[model samples]
Target: MKIARIETFLVPPRWLFVRVETDAGVVGWGEATCEGRSETVRTAVDQLAELLIGQDPLRIEDHWQVMTKGSFYRGGPILGSAVAGLDQALWDIAGRHFGAPVHQLLGGPVRERIRVYGWVGGDEPDEVAEAIAAQVEAGLTAVKMNASGRMSANGSAAELDGVVRRVAAAREVLGPERDVAVDFHGRFTLATARRAASLLADLHPFFLEEPVVPENSHLIGRIAESTAIPIATGERLYSRQEFLPVLQAGIAVAQPDLSHAGGITEVRKIAALAETFDVQLAPHCPLGPIALAACLQVGFATPNHLIQEQSIGIHYNRGADVLDYVVDTRPLAFVDGSIERLTGPGLGIEVDEAAVRDADRRGHAWRGPIWRHDDGSFAEW
Candidate 1:
């Protein structure tokens, strides 16, 4: 079927949704939300629409190649995220046309259920023990929390002890069996990361995410070598080329966000590349249902998949939650911290176009928080 029209909607709680319609009346939906830059990605999608309108909707890979590399200036967050949404929509159409789920089209299932984690503590984490307990009560086995709000370049011993104390609280609530992952959120320098890693070894964290900013990934190998804890990054890296160096740095897990890393088309390749290095794939998804569903489809087909991150009750969802815009919540239903493989066609979760359009009429201007140190130097948030 020929692609007849492409539409994009900027919805509440910081998300951008794309709808692709074909001459045969098949409609497919995908999310291209880049947390703080949803509007820019929407504009990118508008520009990329010139390439897809009147083209064959089923030619997903061909369109992806052209949409990505057709522009000389290629592969940043805006362009990659735009191509990502279009690719997801095209995959959705293909899966429906073939009467199969996206995972089946990608070589079928590798696991029965994909384990997922929930976010507990907020940005400046406090009352973490209670937060962990509440998530455990909700049938979640693992939870992630920010390590600290704003950290000094060379934090005092008290700051280091405070970090340990927060993790210790989570460990106490989770006990020895469950998992607790600390997300440094690129707020630490290499030295601080090494020190924190050394201190947190006794806590047995599942992984340390984004110890430093993506620009400083060259130093991750040293941090990885300093501690036995698994180092996870790549939420900020958009393509396999950006991920190659970090994988070589001895990171045990690769966390690629499907929305920003060229969607399923490119992340599948990223997963394969990670496989060659014996690293596990735990997609970084803190967005809406479509993005989470896309991540699950890849997780189901990937042999080395570790876990999935969902934004069900994540602090980012202020006005609207992940399930609010979906018609059927069953596709996203979580039981015992894992979701059974989705059996529906396309991304598997149907989008509520009515709710989406309504929310678009009252769109949100969501931006990430900015923090500063005690002396007014800029801090990562």
Candidate 2:
């Protein structure tokens, strides 16, 4: 069927959803957003629509290639994220047309369920013990939290100790059976990251995410050599090419966001590339249901899949949570902290188009929160 029109919805709590309509009346849904820059990605999708309208909806690969390679200046967050959402919508259409789930088209699922992790400890991280306990009570076996707030280039010993203390509390609450992932959030310097890694080793974290920023990925191998803890990064990375070097750096886990890494088309390749280096795949998904469903489809099919991140109660979401816009939140039903197989066609979860349309009319202009240090200097949030 030929694509007839492309529509975008800027929904609540920082999400942009895209809808692709075809000549045969079959429509597909996609989540194409970059958190704060939902409007920018929406514009990018609008520009990319010129390449998709009147094209065959089933030709996902061709559309992806043209949408990506068609532009000489391609592959950053805006372009990749825009292509990502469109690709997801096209894949959804293809799967629905064939009466199969996306996983079946991708060689069927390799597992019945994939373990998922929840977010605990907001940006600054206080009362982590209580947060961990609450998530455990909610049936989550693992929880990820930010490692620290803003720190100087030369962080003090007290700052380092505070980081350890919070982690210690989380470990104490989680005990030994469950996992706790500490995200540095790219807020630490090389020396500070190394020091924190060394200090937190005793707490036995599941992984240290983005110890430094993506630019300092070269230091990951050195950091890995310093500590036994697995180093995980790549939520900021958008393609397999960007991920190849990090995998080569001996990173233990590759956390590519299915929404940001060119959707399923490119992330599947990223997963394969990670597997070659014996690196684990833990997709970074802190978005809505469409993005989460896309990640689960890949997670269920990938052999090296480790854990998936869901944004059910994540701090970024305000009025609208992950399940608010879904027609059947049951497909996302988690049991013992793991989501079972999605048996529906396309991305498996049917979105509430009416809710989406209503929310779109109320359109969001959401942006990430800005943080400042004690001296009023800007800090990553």
On lDDT, the leading prediction is 1
Worst ten in a row by lDDT for model 2: 121-130
User: What's the number of clashes in each of the models?
Assistant: 0, 0
Please give each candidate's TM-score.
0.99, 0.98
CA shift of 187, model 2, Å:
0.2
- Candidate topping TM-score: 1
Global Cα RMSD, each model: 0.9, 1.1
Native-to-model Cα distance after best TM-score fit, residue 319 in candidate 1, in Å: 0.6
Write one digit per residue (lDDT tens) for candidate 1, span 1-381: 799999998997999999999999999998899889999999999999999999999888899899988988888888888988888999999998898999999999999999999988635447788888988988889999888767899977988888898898899999999999999999899999999999999999999999999999999999999999999999999999999999999999999999999999999999999999999999999999889999999999999999999989877899999999899998788898899999999889889999999999999899988888888988888
lDDT for 16 (candidate 1) = 95
- Compared with the true structure, the alpha-carbon lDDT of candidate 2 equals 0.90
